[model samples]
Target chain A: MSNNNALAARVRGTVHVIGAGLLGASVGLGLRERGVDVTLEDQSPTTVALAADYGAGRLRTAQDPEPALVVVATPPDVTADVIERALTTYPNAVVTDVASVKLAPYLELLRRGLDLKNYVGSHPMAGRERGGAIMARADLFVARPWVICRDHETPAEALALVEDVALDLGATPLEMTPEEHDRSVGLVSHLPQVVSSLLAARLIPASEQAVGLAGAGLRDTTRIASSDPELWVQILGANRAPVVELLDAFGKDLASFADALRDPEQTGAKRRIADLLSSGNRGVARIPGKHGSSERFTSIMVLIDDTPGQLGRLLTELGELGINMEDLRLEHSPGAQIGFAEIAVLPEVAERAVTDLVERGWRTL
Target chain B: MSNNNALAARVRGTVHVIGAGLLGASVGLGLRERGVDVTLEDQSPTTVALAADYGAGRLRTAQDPEPALVVVATPPDVTADVIERALTTYPNAVVTDVASVKLAPYLELLRRGLDLKNYVGSHPMAGRERGGAIMARADLFVARPWVICRDHETPAEALALVEDVALDLGATPLEMTPEEHDRSVGLVSHLPQVVSSLLAARLIPASEQAVGLAGAGLRDTTRIASSDPELWVQILGANRAPVVELLDAFGKDLASFADALRDPEQTGAKRRIADLLSSGNRGVARIPGKHGSSERFTSIMVLIDDTPGQLGRLLTELGELGINMEDLRLEHSPGAQIGFAEIAVLPEVAERAVTDLVERGWRTL
Candidate 1:
């Protein structure tokens, strides 16, 4: 391997990645891109070989020198065992696991009373809808959060090694305790997953006509319901306490919201319903601007023909008009010759942008 | 006035629109585009004049003839009263409404024991995030499903008149009973709104760290939660029964999911959780393609610099490659110099498309 890439300058030895599935393969591919040697291992021989064939890494062998870092990217259920095994196999290396829930595996390791000074727990808040070696990408972690659980006892050198990997892979690393990490993900990730799943599940029994009325709102609220069930089961099981509490609290909110709406004639019922919904406005505003673009930006829809480059030309025209796009979305109906390119810009520029586009012989609806 | 527009060729007289809000002004604008004579009215003098100034329609005058059709586009709470007033004021005209809820207003008008042969209830199933005449678009209803309520007493001419309006505005009209309309929207629209709101409201108490970890999943699930609270409260109250029932069912689903996770060691508990999640997969599949792009398309993210025309150049290159896009989304970090253009294409061509793009010197992830 060439030593010219950036990571090779900092990483002293090979980085061994365990369980060459989506995350592990992605890690290997990204490290290899940075000229660091990587060794792949997985229980499934086919998966490991496939990842290696895709240039993620070469197969691990005894002749290879002991790695400087071992990343355990197994599923949550097997994470603790794999972390323990990796630490034993790579005795001189700093070990880190990329499991979604940090607390359970860390607790299991502590229960065994192993020498854990070299082990770190981290989770990159990044994933695709599907998981496998073929589904992996070198830039999967780009511009996403990678939470690293650090304790006072952890060595500074070990922490730096893990954070460096995140930084090299284009991820921002944030430090949190295992307990805090679990609780935070429970609120933001697990609870939303369950809620979206249940909401989508409601559509299973709906009439075709009802389902046909589905719009962007229903689609947005249920998009994540399509995640892998088996993977979610393991994740929810590992983070049971916080997830359970969140679900229960959410259940109470749903109940009260329903109660207020069911008999809105009650004196305070209408006020309660409005207040709860208003809280949604406030809570959604708390999400960063990109994540809450609908509230923060104005969308102007432009109509275009079915030909290729029509949309590209439209965006280029917007640039020529000096309209700084906050976000852009293109939607096409299968049988329709026309499509909608909904460009979101700051509310201030919207009217003038529309006037400019229309003046320039473009249709801004 | 040009008599050559499409609606002018078919209609007998002017279309009078009551309530110059988002829906009202949009109906007027779309009809005017088709050369229909549209007269606008609103309780607020400023609103009526504003709609007229925006070319949505002309202000109604005492000297005008009775309209051929009266469209009541007021808020749901005032829909029944507006319909009743329109029916009385324009006795010779066919009266219809564009309120989201159908059953409430229809039932209220029926209970009053007035002649109802001229009234038709319809909902265009279209809206923008913010509502006002300023947000009105002539093409807002294009390609959307507009639900029209019909009954034994509803004359064929009245139904035809309402359906013609829907068709003239480029909407696909579907017929259903009032009960069916309410129930269908209850499952697909109202229920999802309440759930999304409550879920987003949960974020109000979350720490900054938790909100900072938010990803596209959380953002998609909470985007609609920013809708106006006052508008939703009235809509929810008007369609209380179905929405309340749906919420109760969803609450039970949430509770049982937590119960399964709370004791997964129990027999079938893990299966229960997995079954719920799998059901979600099936349910989301029920939504049509335009609303459910995640399931139907493969997303390929491409990196681009902040320079103007860089993204446009990338998309224009895709046109040359002959790869048809299913959908496109662009995301930009406010302070970052880079942006991601996530293009969704058919799964069959994804691998070749990526290879071709990489060969062309584009960085894709």
Candidate 2:
């Protein structure tokens, strides 16, 4: 007992990251990078071997010694079973699970009479369109939000360990209930995927020529549509309640928009379009600016020619003007003579940047 | 007259692109890059002078000699009047207008008994989130489609000149009636903006803490929501009818989805989500692969660490593998131990690249 306290005081125990998939392997790799001893495991021996081979973690078998913390990184469908098994298998270790949706697993654990004291539920608000262990990276959690859904019964030590892991991974931790996490994710993540996919689906029957004319707008709107169907099926399935509620409200707005369009005289159509478009303005205002600040961006337009090196020239000129571009976009019409380059800058720098560009003999509109 | 025909025979007369904004300046720049003699005009002396300064075209005043073709590149609300004025001012010149919506101006021209023989209506399927003449580029239309709406009365010479213009700008030309063009754009362009804006609007009421946690999924879904409100307001206002119709259909689907969510036990909800998701799958299928081909992309996942040089190393290694990356994405979660890196390559080369990476001791999941 004295030795245990001594070890805990000097260093956190080895972290055992289970599954060796994107999240699991990343956890192991990140902990290892932080000088924490990490052991990686997976149901598939080949996967476990591959993960270790890639330096995510050292391999650990079921019979291996218990570690200080255990992270169950698996699909939502199986997270609960994995967590229960981990708890039973490593009674001395603090346990956690990183899954997209939370309520179901938490409920399942309660039903199974698992020790709630050792387990903290977490959802890392980061992911790519691809999946699997191969996609794991040590810095995946850096600067992103990690939500910890804590219950009253969660042990303080376990919570502290998890927080330490999150901090070590360079993540900003937020605290919320399982329900709040589910609802928030439903609105921000799951609903957007559904909407994007639906919009993309509309193009299925489009003529090759029409589809060919697609620009960055369609690409951006449908990017999430390319996500794996099976995984999303599970995600949407688990978060159906909140997702459904959000979709319903969206439907009302869409219906109102449609009604306005169908008006014979355009009076109602203009109002509807105005309302919808204005709503977007308001919505955009709510988004945090780059680097988590809320400051609005000022857009400046620069005229560019339809020639090679022109864009490079403009960017170089902007660099020379000392304009730190927040965002940049280009507008071109097929068979048109010129292209428009729109650059977003911090609101404060917008006027100076515009004046500098104008003085440099570049058109600013 | 002989000199005019001679010039028209060997080389097209100078195409004057008016307004020099995103659309107008692009037209001039595109033609000039194709070695066509082009003149640019705009009401604002500063804008006209800037276009000349950028080499998009030479500045021409109202008193200047007419060109063979004149493109009225202006805002939608003002396009018809410009077209009418251009026709009157340049009686010998063939005329066209580049606007987002079509039916309104065509109708207005027809009602005013303008010289339809010299004029055609066109909408280029290209744009950026930003606006204005200064953002113009010469190759913005490269490989994109330009839709030209023509009636029986459109002069053959006028149509030919417009087609030449589109080709010169490196755009594919498509012919359609005004109604067809409006309906098509309504589905592909206008509807997507409304949906995106509506989705973004939901974020307005969300807690700042939650908004700060957003990742690329939310960003992609809401990117277009940051579009210029004044310009969109004009586009939406003009194309209300068809946009409304599409939104109604979307609303119906959304309602069905909501019903399914309200009762999870019902297969209806499962089917709804599945159907919506599947629709996205089908829609994604319609998008052209990289390099404007229809081939499927092969996706590969690689594990990366959070260190500064880790991503660069992976990319460099992939380059060493002789694998050309078509697209790449990274997912970073705040307060987590790892991240994900997804890469897309040609389908035929996927396995070879994956094997090479694995041999190089990189994790493949």
On DockQ, the leading prediction is 1
What is the C-alpha lDDT profile of model 1 across A8-126, one tens digit per residue? 86789999999999899999999989888999999999999999998899999989999999999988889999999988887889999999999999999999988899998999987
In candidate 1 the C-alpha lDDT for residue B32 amounts to: 89
Top lDDT prediction, candidate number: 1
Docking class of 1: medium
Alpha carbon lDDT of each predicted model: 0.86, 0.76
C-alpha lDDT (0 to 100) for residue A164 of candidate 1: 93
Error of 1 at B8 (Å): 2.5
Error of 2 at B128 (Å): 3.1
Stretches > 4 Å off in candidate 2: A1-14, A33-41, A52-66, A88-91, A111-115, A264-272, A295-365, B1-16, B29-46, B49-67, B88-92, B113-115, B138-140, B298-365
RMSD of each: 2.7, 5.6
